[model samples]
Target: MASDPNTAPHLFDRALLRARMDRARRAGPVAFLLDRVVEDMADRLQAVTRGFSDVAEIGSPGELLPWPLADRFASITRVDLDESETLPLEPESLDLALSALALQFVNDLPGVLTQIRRALRPDGLLLAAMVGGDTLTELRQSFAAAEAECEGGVSPRVAPFADLRDIGGLLQRAGLALPVTDVDRVVVRYDSAFALMADLRRMGATNILIERRRIPTRRATMLRMAQIYAERFADPDGRIRATFDIIWLSGWAPHDSQPKPLRPGSAKSSLEAAVKRAPK
Candidate 1:
């Protein structure tokens, strides 16, 4: 059954929705900045394909085609889920699935993965990239301090991120085989912490926790956060640095007739010996 938006596990809060709307309004500049990263990921995915008759791109529209890789796709469908439980596609239909910087917002990551796996045909490939735990250290620290001063305690400002190991495990749990995961850290420098927040907002990435309680942040808290951010994580040139850890994951659906290497006894010599004797 499709989960209700209100009752869904990964519901985005009002503050987060407002943030995303604000970011969407300024998508022009944000898209420009993120173009390079999107293009790189697309290129990598393209290289792995022999040919794809059907492809599905989740999340950002601009990420799919900075210039126009759409021509290469046989049937390209874009899926964007905001406050929804199920993907808007049939099961076992897609040949290739790609998502860049999109999965972090999902409240039910495992459920979402199940949907993706179901959407792919036998042997279909899924490649995704999402922001991971080490992202926005400076901003998180500042927010923690602000919460400590303004509120009695701090609630998580940014949503929790999945680690590489966890992501691989998620793929396995979702019934995806040959799952591989890796991380890439992109360090961005800004004139101030405010600029960093502005960039994130422009990228349609802001707080969207559905369970978040309303607590107005004081101006003093903001200022203190900025001060701490600058002092603690500033570069020698006095600019603030924010690190975005991008996690890359790829997997294939299991198939009954999939080829397998010889078993231990099937080979004359040990597997290690066979590998050593094979051509370099």
Candidate 2:
């Protein structure tokens, strides 16, 4: 059963995340990841034969729809990250919904997707991209190893990411039809783990887990983490690798025109008969 949005466990510090985002915006966000996903989303949108007149972009740092996409929609609404749990739009109000590099921080992902599903019109579409799978795996492992050896234990350093199958299941659970999910893994090279950490701050993607260590990481532990990262994940040139897995999800509001699955025992021919008829 899906948990109530109001009572969902607080896995993230949303207030802190908001402040971090504000600071990153003031300093100019590191938008390479966002740009890449938006471009890919635009390409996907272009491939669809139909057109969307009304659209909403939820939880994006800034305007993401490019020129042609913006032109396609008669009206476009941009919702901030804080409002994702309870959307302002009415039921059946939107023909399309888009989100880029958001939703991962959401405490109740199923609740948010349910809200989005409610807002979409019959046959309306939802397209989103979020960090998931093995994103920042190297850093996460290095931190764990360093903390285990130096600090004697590991606290939550990086946020947990959902796998593609898990996301697909959420879409289905939210009453969406024909749900699809895929991953695009990106490997970034950095001179050191510190460089990667700096970029994460610039992207407003630093640690905000509710269980994160409130105190600063020890300097010795930090140094050891960097060293472990270099020793394990470094390339031929000595630069370390950081991974970001962008998981894409799409689903449509149920409609009669949409394809339906075959019912159990509905097949007219038996598998044995079909195999017998095949060429040797």
Candidate 3:
């Protein structure tokens, strides 16, 4: 059955994204961002004393996770990118699930997350990281300015990313408990805007929006974009800055062992009384 457009708005062209990823893999994937995220995931996992037996990793580039999880999980299943939406896993099969730097491209994030939640065992953990919140703001701004100047109008050049609060709500909507969200803002400097574009190409992170312009960007527009980027986002040292906000999200499947919130009207002390007891 066709998905309802209201619930599953198709923002990304998944086929194009897959092709780009294949091209990047053939050209030796430039995976600095993925590597960084994997390391952070490792550190976070260290804080949890419990061990996970059946774990699934989605969107992780080429063995980036195996090193950190070498002696850990009994089985590590790698979910293919094509199966991102369906997530071909049995219900309540996984003890842990993780995705790195990939969920942002999913067309139906809520549906995908619901699938993950269902696949997780009771009290199983779900940890993921995705780019969001002002990521590529410089490029988006530069392109908008340049396109408006050169083409009389602007087109969709960058993907819209979710914010921290939106992700937290998604976790709750997916029936995951104790939803926690955080951000890791990483600012990278490049010699020029063109250099940053090249890195994005190498990373296969170019615009694959469903409504993206089909024709090639005009040379004049490209040049003007570079000029505007330098003018607005470059530092005194002549390097342009790009911001990438990595939003980290973690939640657990509901279980009796987990703590539950108090009933709405079950508080012993009134708000006024609590305020009077506050440190002054």
Candidate 4:
């Protein structure tokens, strides 16, 4: 089914985004942020389990989930952003579906997630990460201030990121079993705000907001923004701080054999009695 146009805002230009990513790939390692995201995702995936018979990794680019996960899955199929948006998998065919630093751009996030749930075999798993939760607060603030000071207004520069509470709720709404979500926060240091922007460009993560300003930004305004960024977020060494929060979510497709939480009032021992039995 197509996404509801009334409620869903087209906030991103996805074709342009793909072009940006292609350019970034040609440039190579413009930003190390996604690399870190993929690395952490690999660790998380490894910690939970290993060795799946059939797996699909969606929306991961270049290096495709790091080298460590190569032999763990018997087969790994890669799907880009467009495929993930339209989830073209056979129902109940996949043993595992994984994505990294993606899915935040989808116009219909809930619908996409539900489709992913449907694609998984019963008891199959979905482990994914998206850049979110104050990921670029410093840059957002800097750009807003610069735009307001230079043009007396600010246009949308950073796409709004999803929150953990809403994300967990979405997992449940998608009918995922035993859903879990966690936020991983990391602070990276850059020599300057300009350097940070350069990296964002290389990452193909620069502003692709549909409502972004059409004209080029003024150099003087950009300089002022850089100054403000340094004054507000610079560290002891004068390097500016950038925050990236990778929200990780995982769930299993429902099956009769999987463990289920005890029903309310079905606990064998009471909390009060357990407390009483504890040593001082």
Count of clashing residue pairs in every prediction: 6, 0, 0, 0
Sorting all predicted structures by lDDT, with the top scorer first, yields: 2, 3, 4, 1
lDDT of 4 by residue, 1-280 (tens): 3345456677788787888888888887564666777777777777865357788887766655557666777888887667236777888988899987778877678877888888889999999888888989999999899889988988888889998998998999888999999999989899999898888888889888888888988898889899999999999889999998889999999999889999999999999999999999
Locate the minimum summed-lDDT window of 10 residues in model 2. Answer: 80-89
Q: Which one is best on TM-score?
A: 2
Q: What does candidate 2 score in Cα RMSD to the true structure? A: 1.3
lDDT (Cα, tens digit) per residue for candidate 1, span 1-280: 3334455565555345545755577665466435655776767766875566798888653546545666777788888755554688798999888887778777767878888899999988888888886888779988898778776788767767778889998898888888888887888899998898888777777777765656766788888889989989998999989988888899887777666557867866787988899998
43-125: candidate 3 lDDT, tens digit per residue: 99989988899999976655646675647888889996573367788999999999998899988888888888999999999
TM-score of each: 0.84, 0.97, 0.95, 0.90
Look at candidate 2 and tell me the lDDT of residue 158.
Answer: 94
Cα error of candidate 4 at position 168, Å: 1.1
lDDT of each: 0.77, 0.92, 0.90, 0.83
Range of the 10 consecutive residues with the lowest summed lDDT in candidate 4: 1-10
Residue 129 error for model 3, in Å? 0.4
Candidate 2 local lDDT, 1-280, one digit each (tens): 4568678878899888999998899888898999899899989998887889899999987678865667888999998768336678798999999999889999999988988899999999999999999999999999999999999999998999999999999999999999999999999999999999999998999999999999999999999999999999999999999999999999999999999999999999999999999999
Task: Give lDDT for model 4.
Answer: 0.83
Task: Give the higher-lDDT candidate: 2 or 3.
Answer: 2
* Highest lDDT against the true fold, candidate: 2
User: Which regions of candidate 1 deviate over 4 angstroms?
Assistant: 1-8, 14-19, 26-29, 61-63, 66-68, 149-151, 256-280
